[model samples]
Target chain A: MTGRDRSGGTRAWGLTVAVLAALAAMWPLLPDYNQITLARVMVFAIFAIGYNILFGYTGLLSLGHALFFAAGLYAAGLGARDGGLTAVPAFLAGILAGAGLAAGVGALALRTAGVAFMIVTLMFAQAGYLALLYFNEWTRGDEGFNLPAASRTVLGLELAGADMRYGTALALFALATLIATWLARSPLGRVMVAVRENEARAAMLGYDTGRVKLAAVTISGAFSGAAGAAYGLIDGYAGATFASVQYSILPLLWVLVGGAGTVLGPLVGAVFMFYLIDLTSGLTDAYMLVAGAVLVLVTLFAPRGIMGEVRRRVARWLP
Target chain B: MDFGPHLMLAAIEGAVAAAVLALTALGLSLVFGVMRVVNVAHGEFFMLGAVLAWAVAHLVPGPAWAGYLAALVLAPLLVGLLAAAADWVVLKRVQYDPERTIVATIGLLYILQQATLMAYGPEARPVAAPFDARIALPWPEWGPEGLVLTWPWGLGTTAWKLVVIAAAALLVALVFVLVQRSRAGLVMRATQFDRETAQAFGIPVARVFALTFALGAALAAIGGVLVVPIQQAHYLMGGDPLLLSFIVVIIGGLGSLRGTVVAAILIGMSDGIVSVFFSPTLAKILATLLVAFVLIFRPQGLYGTRAA
Candidate 1:
């Protein structure tokens, strides 16, 4: 409880090491099909981690993060498809595009707080989706565009093969987790938490709350974009579905289920949700209903999420 | 200059859109105004109403008019009751926190939409209009010789469309009166103004919130029932209405009834006219951009007063 006793940095680093080691060990053991699923889980885990930067730490619940994710996906995909770019350059373009878009949108969206902020983001994301849908010639509309394998080579590593793609996803997931963990303990991250806890007090304490939030949003957007680019490359396809409102909600769902504000919570949340849907998808057409029920149950009974509850129970043993 | 007939048709279409949007947006605004909780699942209630109308009209073994009339009255009531029960079970449990309620209602949205998909199937089903009549619209045309009045061949609107406009307008008016004049209206206003004081004054604030939520949902359901005759009932139909209603509520100022109606008309009219002139996608894109601008410049909304 004391400042010296708060070993958050050590705990975060330890968890990161354990998780990466486990993932690296599991990568070879997983069958090809399960590898693909694990790759997707890692992709979504990156997304949920990026989202938590805004929602979990800053307490800004944006209902439109899919816009950034989609922007990144399209930028990276199109770079390969049209710009004749290699994988690294294309993915960087995606990150920059998503970050730039989020910066611009965050400036406008952050003007309003709470519900207004949520609605504004939703509207912008919807517009992005509609634009993507309407501009069918370039985006292939809803038909979905394929990512050519020739352009998927990053640093001489072809991402087309399942093993290569899984390895890339795992690497990216590890890097994203490390970055997120580092940021959460940074001084800027402290200011963000202060803003989240009480914006007025933070402002009175000489913190430019707006700037902090903008920075958070921009950083979060960049990470989400990177995840999206990875997702597009991993799947070797890109489409309008990436920009949907439903996709936007998915990260939030994962974060809430895993535990908001915690570094590793999103990973746990993403894995649980991906498996839950994957397992139930074959059994019934109402997996959405199951997901919805789980959401409500989590909101009501387990607001702290799976990891949050676990942390609470094993507080002394874990940290 | 010579776009008169097309303009008239567009205006008629706008009126129809405005009519339905007004009812749907009014409910959304009322819930926000009274409870300060945004109901993301409000559109599902509208979808429910439409689906229920289809079910009732089909299940009732009677004349088409009789069944249609029964559905028109019963569907909204049933949806309202369903929404009220949800509020009791889920919303109340969350204690109506704005953020949590948004997530809760989102869950409700998926639950309702998927339930309907499971029960009603994925097909879009139409309800027969209570009556079959098309009134031709006449417009003045300028010819080489002179100006003349002529009835456009396919510019006629159905009798039911006009009826829907009239009925929706009447319902909106009735809601205004109920909110502005009745004793229940006073209690609602008091509760909206200050909840603790209203509770202290024996206004039964909790019941009022539940009633307001139910009433808002019922209003949306009524809009759905009315529009089903034209658009058909489907599982996935709630998305647009929900989006449009949010646009209307936000631009009108959250919880302001008058603002909501005015914004609905402006948006609906522009949507109709723009769709006719350009493209439906363009209309939606423009409306969404307008919401972004509104949030930046006037976060309090067009008519919403600053919060104390």
Candidate 2:
């Protein structure tokens, strides 16, 4: 509704650098327990950022991104276990699997728009989840599979410890955030915004809206997939629950609360929700009740999300 | 393997499934058709109905029939009221923005589910059927001289199951009549057709929306009440009904009542046969795949008019 940019590119870059520096500084100071939780936050942050490419910037509200996330995690986890490959190779396989799955699903789902697109993606994700459940031989269904401790080692770093896992998660989160920020500023990102703002107008202007959307979905899927891989590596477990609709909705809650389109929204939302869950879980097992209540309050009161609202109010003060 | 008896059994199972699915899907379809907001918590309402039925039947001091009857009438009404309250407290505050309402309903879903879990516990509980006289199904077999009817002992269904089918059909018909014939229906249709214009013409648009939402929930609740006797009630029972209802709604065409019924019957029947013959998981997979196909090839659905 108002101007978001108030200064030259340097301000935004500086802000990002400052935020990353602050996060990096907290690594050593955070206790072991907090470190593990923070690692999870980082993985989910990666998910939210990738999800933002389609939902936040591109105006696609998918309830099925968990499909790709799980795909990526399983691809990497299983790849490492089955192929006896190292972290980098297994992670690469996960990216390919995630991207490939996204491309395939995107090609079909892109044909529909609005609510139909959401349902279509959900259907695909549901089917994928069911497949995971039924094909117990591969996925172990709901029983879940534990990663062999050795596979946790990525790039010669043994990630069996909290510090190493957290470090890996931090590096991945930084890379994902930087990539997402760069993409958001790219010409392709502008086109994605155009498609989001008005699809018909973008099509009239000779942009293949479908192709643009497909590209966005694929990119988003790849990021989610990478996040999934990292998540498994960080947690040392993989399960069909990774692909559930609940996981799909989790990032949505994060992005919506943090701020949909903003680069920092996912990070903020992920940290806020991660801690919120931790705090509520400490209080009672009925943490979901609290989470659900927060979702309602935020959606009703802060539909633009915390950062989005803050930006709107303090436009001149922000990048 | 002789498949005739199995086919017959599957058809009977499908009929029962279709009866309940029609009610649930119809509710979802009505909410979408009228309010233009997808209540992601629609399944939760169905769960509430079943759960409440269990509560009412258990807590109310009466004969089993009395409790069953009370649940049959009261559970849906209570859930309807709850839905109406939700519409007022939450949806109205948000101005019923489609996307935002979805998130709100998701929140509502968690709240309802968790609340149920806290109150009722996670274990599945079965309600005693009002009357469950087992009736043996007769199949025509060719004798040496002529065709004769042979009774199969294993192929027997409870009279209550038939009652469920009958009751659901009657309710569906009653809903159709009320929507088509009543003055309240007129208001709902008016609001659905053009909310702004309807408001200009002196329609209580908000009330109509609220009422429509309640009615939708009530229908699903009624469906849930009917099925609780057959399927055990649990906090997690809502997920499948929600997904199945969505599949029915999508295939039948969003907001198309007639299409919803047709699609429900098709899906219900297929699900019944497949689940019995193959596996329930396979049935669900097929349904999900069918939704994908419908979305890709016929996004407008079978009966949905193309958006102008």
Candidate 3:
């Protein structure tokens, strides 16, 4: 919005580049298990970042992003397995499916605001989950399916290798991060925030608030869709569990914990959440007990989440 | 085997489901109406009731009827108290802010689920019905001269299922009496109407909120207790009921008790009939989409006047 914001953006760009460099450098040193976990973290990070566009910026709390994510997963998984598309084409198909679904969902769902929107989206996702189960011959139901080992090769880089897998995930994460930060600073992004702050006011200014919301959701789907596509391809699995309400709640949780409306919050939140679960599960089978307790405490004391808090107290230009 | 008898069986089974759903959805309506907060963990409370009933039944070394009856009586009460405590410890601290409450309750859901997993294990465990007797149902058939009654194959229901229907109706009746006639009901209604004004009148709105939350949970628990004999108690059992009750609550209209029950019956009956007509998953998908369309086209719900 100002010159200061631009310079803040530059500094942020430098910081991101340095961070990426460090991550790239550390890739070879990390163990095989850690590399896989890190890839998962980046995938969730992409999911959260994409989710933030609508939830954090547009102020639309969708409990159905899992539908888009799973749409992407299935689109890619099936395309490569059955449609005989290459890895890139399969991934593109996933993103297109995700965006198309989000646009369709937003068309009807956006008519209702607030809680109605949430419930409508939830029901749609519920339908999607059931659809996945109903078409079990194709989806393999709850058990999910794996792509052929050859299908795992993306752009001639075999994701079967640990380094290639982690590098590809990191590359996707960097792309998502760049796009997210750009969107946050873009004119449409400001309009989205305007809508979030006050939809009536935004509409009064002659902005098509509905379109902006739909756009936000569609773009969000594209982002998370890429994550889902990458995740299925890299992880070699696509399953119904990823389409469940639990998956929907996970992105929301990550966004809230990382700081809503912040470009980098999703990454921080996803990493923190990943490590938190990883560490807790090592000690006990009831890792979710600890996770639940942390959620309560975070909501109680740090409602702004990690990055939201960071933005407030330390980094005024975090976004 | 025939369409008429199959439809009849679906209707009866649907009634059984409607009975349970009404109990669950009514509870949801109360909490949403009075407290104005969505408790995402409501189904977990239901799961707890069934799990607790199983535990209680296991502890009681007696006839199956004796243990089952004890669980039916005790589980809901215990769950209500637990829900009230949760409200005090978690919800009250958050001031019942709608979004925050959702997150907190989700957190509460995880805690409850993980605790159950730790203590109860991941297995689906079932408790026996207090009494079970199969009785054949007669279908009317047109003869050459007159009408005759014929027993249809697979048209029998257990005595316990009828008991569930009766028990649910009685509990629902008790809730109506409590809400419409009792002093606490008046307080709850007052709070629901206007929280600040009720507080000004020294209504102890906070306590009413707690009571409303507890009662909602208890109703869901009763549903769970009744259902446990029919289905096993699993940690993951809460998810479907949660989705179905949400559909009922929305289709019924938020905070509209009559509408909630009506929608519950409508949904439950359709669920049964549709499952019989098609696949169960297809039935669920249709019901879910129905709620979404209902909310989109008529946010007021079937019986609701206001777009709540």
Candidate number of the best DockQ: 3
DockQ of each: 0.62, 0.61, 0.68
Q: What's the residue-level lDDT of A203 in candidate 2?
A: 96
Once superposed on the true structure, which residue ranges of model 2 sit more than 4 Å away at CA?
Answer: A1-8, A315-319, B132-157
**Candidate 1 deviant stretches above 4 angstroms:** A1-8, A316-319, B134-157
DockQ for candidate 3? 0.68
Write out the backbone clash pairs for model 3.
none
How well is each residue in B1-308 modelled by candidate 2, as lDDT tens digits?
34665676677789899999999999999999999888999999999999999999998896888899999999999999999999999999999887788889999999999889888888899998875445322223322212222334433344667788989999889888888898887888888889999999999888888888999999999999999998999998999989999999989988888999999999999999999999899889889989988988987788988520
Per-residue CA lDDT of model 3 for A186-234, tens digit only, reads 8999999999999999999999998899999999988878888988888
lDDT by residue for model 1 (B100-199), tens: 9998888889899988989999999999877654433222232222222333443334457778898999999999999999999999999999999999
Q: Write the per-residue lDDT of candidate 1 for residues A1-319, one digit (tens) a residue.
A: 5554467557658878998999999988989988888998999899999999999899999999999999899999999899987788888988998899999999999888888888889999999999998888899977889998887887788887779878999999999998888898888988989998999999999999999999999998998899888888888899999899998889999999998888888999999988999888887787788778778888889988888888888754232
Q: Give lDDT tens digits, candidate 3, residues B99-147.
A: 7888888889999999999999999998888764444222233222112
List fnat, each candidate: 0.64, 0.66, 0.82
Clashes of each: 0, 0, 0
lDDT of all predictions: 0.88, 0.87, 0.87
Candidate 2 overall lDDT versus native: 0.87
- Model 3 residue A146 lDDT? 89
